[model samples]
Target: MMGRTRMIGGLTAIMMILAMCAGCGIGGDGAHDAVQKLMDAVVAGDVSGVKNLYTLSVEPKMPTILTGAKLKQPIQNVTVGESEKVSDSERTVPVSYSLNGKKTAGSFKVKQDADKNWVIQNPPVFGQVSFDPDLTIGGKPSTKDNKFALPIGVYEVNMVSDVLEGSWTVPVKASSGFDYQGITANKNRKKIKLTDKIKTYNGSMSSLIDSFNLLPMCRKLKELYLNGDDFAFISGKSISSACKYQTTDIQIKVTDYTPDGDRDGYYPIKFDATVKMIAPVFTDSGENDDVWTCQSVQGGRQCAKFVEQSFELKDWDGLVSQSNGNVYYRLADPDQNVGELADVIYAGHGVD
Candidate 1:
């Protein structure tokens, strides 16, 4: 019985020693290994591997923003120093590495969770700014800071909140054309304001009538009067200055609006209008012997005859309305989906 007791005591002592060694391997050495693995994952641009070493609570939420620009730099060397225990469950590991031909220093923390598994409490430190087409703006390479104020023009902006993982594109255009009205964006995202240029009828009776040129027509009549063979020469029986053609009661209506893709702020519209004008004509009296002449009486003078004519003008393309009130035509930008406004303010907006 005494011999059996001694053997049991010896076995218990050996088991305790083995347990101490196992604890040290998992708690101290394991933490140091976790820190090294984190740095290796960053250098390799392995976001999944990096997350695997993080605490379960933080792993899913970890952002790959640091990998945005750093992944392009190759990791030349990495040296990890001894870990210092903060408590029974946590440790800090010191690190130094060469990246992209430059030396850098940083630190991280590792901890043993309730299950006694080693995980990175803090990941390797790195800062990055990732952009589309490899961080360039206005055909120039971008600086470390991500913000940019580009000149007003058309641009295809590449966007990536975390460059290492994936990216999307943003098409931005700002100019005097009728298409792009405004734009909104942040560090890695952007939005373009869409609008449509609509054609409207804003002309008045007076404005439409003023567009007619009657001077040329009047000159043609003067030529007819000078031909004495056609007209009789009589005292006070000639074309008088008082004889004039006049337009009255002009009615206009706009039925529909259509967009033309080729022009800016100019579109086609359907229009209908009634035009009434006085026609000054020399009466052909059929008295072959008597030449054409004006008639005059004491109280009133009636020279040439006066005739009233009414006509309708309708067209699909000939008529147009102004989108910008300052002009006489309508215009639109095909690239932008914007609603119609009286005056399209297109020149000053930009993306930040």
Candidate 2:
């Protein structure tokens, strides 16, 4: 009877030990399955499925920025290796897959949630990547905390600030750790000088200036000046009857070139321009024909009366292209300060 009791006790102990081992095995297998499911979801582009597999502790709710994100290379032939137990509820599972016809290996940190369901702790993704509030990733605004996330791929990062603005591309890899050092605006930027040769959409600066017709602008200003409220009381003194205006000898010399504060591929230019304005005096002939003739002034008829005006002009809001040390002027808002002049000379000749 004693031997039989001893045997029964040994059997009970063995059974208990087997039960505990089985529980551990189940936990490890569950973690492995969870990792496999995550890769499957990524391959299928199932965002919701991917979200469901992440650990509950993840912040910002997995970041919707990954909604349309994609892997640089589609994963194929995924093989989930054995899970290394970390604790009763946590495990690390090794995973291997084919990417772009090449074998790639990675791991997933998995743990059980409150309900004992396996979920990924360290997902093979990037998230909570911080940047300036005016920065954008892949052309989309960042989430709260100036953070964003993306799948394993290359992305275009851009930032707009008062100090500087620029764009660059970055690669986000799986399980590489989120050590993004943020973005810098100095990439691909080069300092330019006013003497640097520049090309515009129309052509060279000289050609662009040559194409501009200053007669219309001059005439409009002269008309406005002559028809001012001070002269409103003057009758039969139309612009055509008073003085004829003409523009000649227009020239431009660029003084400075500056980049836009908020964007790349844009520049503001300042220049000095000299133009000759001629106003020929006209007198009414005392005949019913109403013909007008040039009148003598200062003992000289058809007086070679002309005013050479020098103007300071700037196009501070222009789009200029820079490539391989060559600059191209795109478009700009001409800002000229020709105070009290008959007309304003537009900088860049309104090169839009």
Candidate 3:
């Protein structure tokens, strides 16, 4: 009976030892091995290998951003330390590696998947990010300190801030060891004042109108004057040559300026303006049938028969401008008919 009890006790002790050994192997060594593989893949620039080692949750979220991103300098002398078990299926492993001949240490959290294979739980963080809370990353609000532990990838940063009253969008590339200062410190960020924006819009208005060939209103009036009972007397070409539209004394009074709530760098302004369009009519002088009527003026001739119109325009919107000097305005609204200039007019309105 004693011999049988001893044998049973020995078997139980052996089983317990084997179970503990198995647990240690999978929980500790497995995580360290996985990290080592990851380091190797990174050094070799094997993106596929690196991606395969990531946990399922992290792999898909970062693949596009990680594509084509490689370190400028290869990581060398990578040593993965022993894994500290967090749970039955998780471990935290410390790693040291030389980059640019400088040694650095970091930690990686790893977890076991259903297959009991260790994988990286967190995506590799690439940069030290500090930015204003008002700025958004990938349309999500940033934290106060803005230390974004984002995976290696490119992200669109919206620099529109209520505090700064600035609006712009910029591309931020998150790469290994990148330091992203807030948009306020970014050299590429552009912010234009409301006064400058208004000035730019007003200054480019005439050219904007002319480029769109919106003088057809004046042309139509000339066509009406030239029409006679015996078929239309003026040819299309003749009407074009005889009538010209001139804009002067442009005055704009902005009644309200509203910044776009959703999009940065877009403003809808409501304003009233008095714009003068002078359409000169040329007719044959009684003295000479072939000569058009004209009176000498300062530096130019004043047509004897001409139409002068002063337009009191009001409630205009969809005037969009960027700090890069790009100005876009909607001219297609039926209420604001300047004659098919364009559905939208794009002009460069750089502040002087």
Candidate 4:
């Protein structure tokens, strides 16, 4: 949510700056001259001149947040917004520059940098660079371009191919719109790649995760949770979801593999999940979405819901994994019915 807000604000600011600079005598050369003047003023220790060029919230200096020489010299970073070309003027344009740690106001400008890089030149009546990303280099605070950014993190991948079909790789990559929660919520979550290729059936390298859902086991586990039962003995069995139960069974599936089927990472991670209910006997098979209270079974477990079996998912080659990497067995017995549960069970890799 925070990132989304910033993106919108950033775009808006870019557009505004471009529109205003359209009248300036701004161009590449103008930008250079503007930047050089600002830099010279800064190097000459002219704090007022620098602040005058900034678009502050009125007031030439932030007496409290940032003041005088502190803003122009002691400052650490400046972020120059993208340069806008002036339509009529040959040597003028508008740019936004932010000073770091100043909480000061932003300013508009017209001009170019000393290195011929574009820049905003005018002096503000009472502002200074308060938060410019371009000036955020580690060693030199007065510098711009902050240079290129490097990525972090390490990843491992696995891919399996099909004879006639394409293949699926771990961490399946998918087609994602601009990742918008905007009104046009493009609900279609297909897998598309950087090269613009739609991975119809084969996943590349981003959507791989294995999962299992033992509903009966979960219901039973939930009962244990309701009764404050703990089955901490299961190795790597950290209580994941529905914090109330001890696990009776777990149904997990591998990412690149399918249940009697095949896996293609082009789709979101898919799996059959289950939740078992153990309680005094919450409900019998065939009830609407509901949760009731009851006594307990012989194993010191509460029986808020009576669940006899788990539910297995069918035709699950394409679906999304829970945003949560953890299990979601918490809401198990909201509608407890223990009849004819179709939960999936596996035997390999210590899952049995």
Off by over 4 Å in 2: 1-28, 56-64, 70-72, 75-78, 96-106, 127-146, 154-170, 174-178, 181-352
Name the lDDT of candidate 4: 0.31
Give the TM-scores of the predictions, in the order they appear. 0.34, 0.41, 0.37, 0.23
Better candidate number, 3 or 4, judged by lDDT:
3
Alpha-carbon deviation at 30 in model 4, angstroms = 5.5
Instruction: Report lDDT (Cα) of residue 282, candidate 4.
Output: 35
On the 0 to 100 scale, the lDDT of residue 69 in model 2 is 48
Off by over 4 Å in 1: 1-14, 21-28, 55-70, 130-352
- lDDT by residue (tens digit), candidate 3, 1-95: 99999999999999988876553563538888888888787666566777677754533233223244334445567788888888988888888
lDDT pick, better of 1 and 4: 1
Give the number of the best model, judged by TM-score: 2
How do the residues 131-171 of candidate 2 rate in per-residue lDDT, one tens digit apiece? 54555666665545554555554557665433334566655
Q: Which stretches of candidate 3 lie over 4 Å from their true place?
A: 1-19, 22-28, 56-63, 69-71, 98-104, 125-293, 298-352
Total clashing pairs for each candidate: 12, 0, 0, 68
